[model samples]
Target: MTTVERTQVFLLPDLGEGLSEAEIVEWRVAVGDIVTVDQTVVEVETAKAVVDVPCPYAGRVVALHGAAGEIRPVGQPLITIAPLDGDGGAGDEPAGHATYREEERAGSGNVLIGYGTGHGGSGRRRRRPRLAVAGEPPAAVGTGAVAQTDPTGPADAAPAGTGVTASPGSSPALVISPIVRRLAKERGVDLASVRGTGLGGVIRRADVEAALADAAAPAARLAAVPDAPEAHVGLAPAGDGDVVIPLTGIRKAIADKLSRSRREIPEVTIWVDVDATALLETRAAINAATPDAPVSILALLARICLSGLRKYPQLNAHVDTEGQRIVQSAGVHLGIAAQTDRGLLVPVLRDAQRLTTRELAAELAATTAAARAGTLPPARLTGGTFTLNNYGVFGVDGSTPIINHPEAALLGVGRIVDKPWVVDGQLAVRKVTQLSLTFDHRVCDGGVAGGFLRHVADCVEQPALLVANV
Candidate 1:
């Protein structure tokens, strides 16, 4: 019996939560390897979390579209697979076309965005909208092709160089990725002048970088001339020995978020030093009673925070700038700020108010560990109502950290150390720690913020206050 096989292209699925792109961290499979349906093929890092992307089709891998560390937009081809027949022979139909038909019939499973198995709902996949350039016609549908038009007449097209193929026409330069456009804009490079070497004449990030490098020499020469304008003087180029690192992945995400917070939120910080001796003693006593389940200082502080939020619900809310309202959360989703090698990650414990002290401790410890290991899903990394930052673990006295964006407040704990304290009019050594609350001024004034911090301090100073309140 004759057998035939056709190649199927797997586009990168929507990694969830409206994420547009992901950086490829590692590829688990290579060309010529047979991958089963739902088999993990590549690991990608989005702005929110690291994810293991599974292949929806079972077949022999024909191609891997991206290298590790490359950022691929969603809906871009990720992997190409050739499905094998029962006799292990190739299919009669063309490699690419037959796969699309098969995809329509069998569906690409529930993992991808556009196509899904017919368990429920429509099986048709949605396509990403194409970015239209000047003089370009509306993009053709259902075909993975970009419409390119040269601004200069085709007869006057310039010779291709450095990945740029300039042609004479009335259309603007063909650029795809927004990252490329942003880079060009920031560097003052004219996109209309730079040609695209990417598929279908799309200008890519590399092309913009090349343009920037080519312009650097002439700009420097012009600046070196005597009596020359000092406009670009302060912009020092990197030295040969200097290691210039590009901000990408988690670092870029952090920069964008913190920048947005600074730009939008009107934040205020207030701090107080608390005697944590009683809190420590209470933890030790509880741990001694339940040796199997030891509660951490962070968990105790988290419990204190939950109580404070209950009293001052204003701080437990975020500002909806679009609606011009303070949107308070119904439940406490506690975000624990954890520093990881990848960057700063905040893994949240959902409905934290519902958990007991021991349960909070377990979840906090596990979530933090998973965050540092880069194993937590994207869902676990977002939707936090408030953030808890234990900067004390770094042995620091205090910090005024930026509030995690959208969240109304962040509680920062400094290092706990022995300090002189007055007990019953006598001075004695006690465990002292600084607690700082940075809150959004738009949510509440200093009155509410101070009340919340003071309540937290009261709990730390006298554990009985928390017990009584509970």
Candidate 2:
């Protein structure tokens, strides 16, 4: 018998609560395809972004564990690979061999976002920070009730502490994962009766059924409760009003992310009113020089930001728990926060320092087109070192932007509204724009953040600062 090496291909783990199970969008390689470590093999779409899952082990794909369109839970098997035998088929599974390796570190396990161990057949969701829900009683500290559901079932519903609101004198809706909610909604289960065993009495589907079984009563047989109004009320039907669509998709994501950021991250926001008149002229000149090039202020700002990042690399960092470790990176992958119909997608421009202004504009144009057309690849959404959000395009003066997670700061560029400014003690109407810088106070204090913003402001104010290419 020809002995062949066998490896178990585990399911891709959730990047975070932002994703639960990703749809297997595409499979780059098939059974019998020889793949090396770090080679892109599959594409998966999570709630936040599409990602390419690289091959963990260098071997021949012997079998596919999951099919395309299958939403495999995190820590489940997605594909299987083995050494080709003389006849066929990968040899028997090696004793105590669990093949999984993370991208951050290659080892005996699969890669996952943030931090954790390799996949070792221990299928359990990693514990995350317990966010306080809005208007809800704190977790079972004094409730004097045993939770009927698992707390960690689905933890992404409430943004940090913006907990769900309950009707006056009514019990708060049990917090549950999206999957559980879907199942309960489908089965018409009474979510209120289901006590959660998960952290803080968050409900799970199993908890609902278990609660039902424990009560020895059918969900349908339970006492009826009055129906609540829809979450989002449409435009007032009684009043003469234009169509008012409820917020959804990109708008919703932005709202949730920003709300969570404001409520959670201690933000130190500073503002600088810059005379971007010269910068505007420079951009017009550049764009006029190359008509085909996309030369919006955002593209220019991106390049300017990249240049300034070299001077203050600490601004392009992420603060892990305890506000201790700030992961300051060398490369500048600027995430252009693009609002798409699907949601707010931050497709990254990897290694922005290498690209020229014109090239950056072209790339942004292409990437933005792709995002608008829904053709952006998975790679485009990953590896963002820092982020830039241009509210200017939408014609806003300025507003503090929430920093994208894992990044230390975010720059919000507002509309270049013509405003009167004191130039050398003289009031003058100039093409003015405001730069709102929101920084993670844990990693960087106000002084350092102020310097970064001032530097950028200087670049925008005195276009010479940018022309000098510093």
Candidate 3:
């Protein structure tokens, strides 16, 4: 019997929630390394969060598809593996060369939520062939290098007068990813005029962004000059000690999301200064009673926010811009805004309304720690119906924070400090804190917003109100 070896191509799986692409952060497995089923092969950073992608096959890694810092579209080839047989030789039938029929039998039975290798089939869409290999340098333009053809082929190639050059038998400009194309179209950037620095002269998201910046350079320079005409002015060259950082990854995601929120939502901010002395006392009493499961002020505030939402369910919802309707949530998936080294990440606590104060504290502590460590899965970072921002840790008194996109509201808590308060007509020192609610005006009028803020203030001023409401 003769043995045949065929390499299996593992295409990138569809990361859930309609995410189309991810940037390769790091590769855990190298070519020629043995990998077991469900072993993490690479770490990828999506627009929303960082995720570790696992390989479903057990084999020897033959090739890695993309290099670190490269953007790979979902359904593109990610890795290749060759199955190992007895005596460390290749298998009788290489799984990679197997037909669709053989693929049914060779399925690894592992799934990554939206994608998997099962009896049904590998849910991979065939993409355009890319000539670039991992660790290979990108092709330089105008250097007589033949441009690679994308899926569109020569029919959609850049024209001869568009400043893009092409050698015989190659397209003028290559755009392998649909994401890159959409970005260029949205930004009104002419693809032919923009130089591609990606593998095989392919244009990338960064290329589109750079083209936009270049287009705006003249206007930026004009604004810097005093009473300058609308003429092209050169920007001063960078001096020594000037460092330029490209906005990418999490920082880019944050910028896009916040920009969208600012653009789309009609927001309003209302604040109140409340005496938090009672809230502090209540926490002390709870801790004294249950030291093992002590509660935090944030947890107490979270519980209060849930209570407030119960009364004003409109605040616990998001707007459907296309549908032009306000969609309220049936349950509270509270998002705790935690500032991590990576950036600001909000980890959702599902069914938070049902959790006790102690449980909320423990879960919040664990999730916040995981977020800071950058070990949180992508699923935990999304689907937030409402966000709670505790900027008090930053020593700020109050902030009118932007509402988290899609979500209708955000409750911001400030640091609690001592202040003079009149109790029974006598001035006395009391713990004071400022509470601000930044909400989408589309969800509710000022009356409802004010009522919700007042309810929270009442709870903070007199913790007994929470007991009475309960």
Candidate 4:
């Protein structure tokens, strides 16, 4: 008796915080593998972080949507799963259900990183499922070139488990979807006989259905034709001194962010040299007095930033060009630019203005630790109104740092070193550092920017000024 088997696709999900696409880092399960709900089927690397995506449906994997290293967009099929077959319900008895339809109707109730099999849930609204070929995977769709397509159907289409490698000077068979291949195989039809209408001659489900109707005809029109000119990459010899490295993962994210910041923001930079001798001495005194609970230079600087922001709130605000308004946030959601082992990361601190120096130091330590460990959640990486970049840690004397986008200004602190200074007409050495403030001109003019930088420099030169302000 002929019966219909149902197939469903598990799509690539929005991981968190509105990520669009992710690279297939590794596949935990393979085709023909049986998987239970909540099983991690694949590990993918989003632009900012790596995440393990769990399967929300329990079924047998019929096909993998893409191979490793391919970047797949959300809502695209990640895997095709065939539910247990049933006279009415295939694995009903084991599933504690009456039929396959019942099991599918019940659904996996749990929501994962924006993915769930449930029809009704509080999670993100599920996307409408697009129908695809019952057997063909997205990768098998087309090679994007006519040269890679087989105009003639050959048994060369690799079956499951046998590595399908096209012979030299011959392109790989375009048949990838098992459904399409199975239909042709069962009907005793040659795939090469069918003329492909898919992109660059990739066969589709409609092609298979059309082939079945004209059984009495000579051959299916969608089949690949005779051997065509092969497309192969010309590679340089092993000793080619320079190697090309692809920008991906965190690196790609940084590149995109920086490029966008430069393109959109009309940035201007203003810098000043400050005598940090008082700041250093102040830190030493506080450390010596506190002994165990010593304060950090960053903590003092953070205090000064909050104080300066109160005086000049414009620099602490963001320009919403689209809205044609400046968003002046009351609480400083401060972002600290930290260079971690993974890459440059800016972890945000919510309501940083309310924290004390000691408290700010602790929060900074925790955020930096989380950033370096790559355990900082997506929430910790966004929503900052201002940024404090300590480029001095890199041992640089000065730098014109790019302003973090959305935020109007970024404060950059340079390496503090002993330098020649005129102290009351006497030439002497004093600890000094260069401070730079890169700001969006649309948000504020040079006067506002200069006022903010000078205020920070004043606090550095005279710590007593911050104490009085506090």
TM-score each candidate: 0.71, 0.53, 0.70, 0.65
Over all chains combined, what TM-score does candidate 1 have?
A: 0.71
CA RMSD per model (angstroms): 12.4, 15.6, 11.9, 14.4
Comparing 2 and 4 by TM-score, which wins? 4
Per-residue alpha-carbon lDDT of model 4 for 58-82, expressed as tens digits?
A: 6655667766557899888787666
User: What lDDT tens digits, residue by residue, belong to model 1 across residues 1-470?
Assistant: 32113567789998776789998765665444455556666778888877878777766555677755578999898877667654443333324333344543353575753222343322322223233253333211112222122434333221111112223573467654544644554344556666678887777888867766774422231123346333332223333222224577778889999999999999999999999999999999999999999999999999999999999999889999899898999999999999997799989999999999999999998999999888888888889999999999999989999999999999999999999999999999999999999999999999999999999999999999998767
Off by over 4 Å in 4: 1-8, 16-18, 28-41, 58-64, 80-242, 289-294
State the lDDT of candidate 2 residue by residue for 111-173, as single tens digits.
664222333233222233333232453222111111122345444333211233343555555
User: Candidates' lDDT values, in order?
Assistant: 0.73, 0.62, 0.71, 0.68
Clashes of each: 13, 20, 0, 26
Q: How well is each residue in 1-470 modelled by candidate 3, as lDDT tens digits?
A: 32223556678787776678888765665544556555667777887677778776766565677665578898888877766654444434334433332333264556464222333334332222332221222322111222222333333332111122233444345665544554454344556566789876777779877877773421122222246433322222232222234467777888888999999999999999999998999999999998999899999999999999999999999999899888999999999999976689889999899898888999999999988877787788889999999999999999989988989999999999999999999999999999999999999999999999999999998888888776
Off by over 4 Å in 1: 1-5, 91-108, 112-240
lDDT of 2 at 57: 60
Candidate 4 lDDT at 125 equals: 22
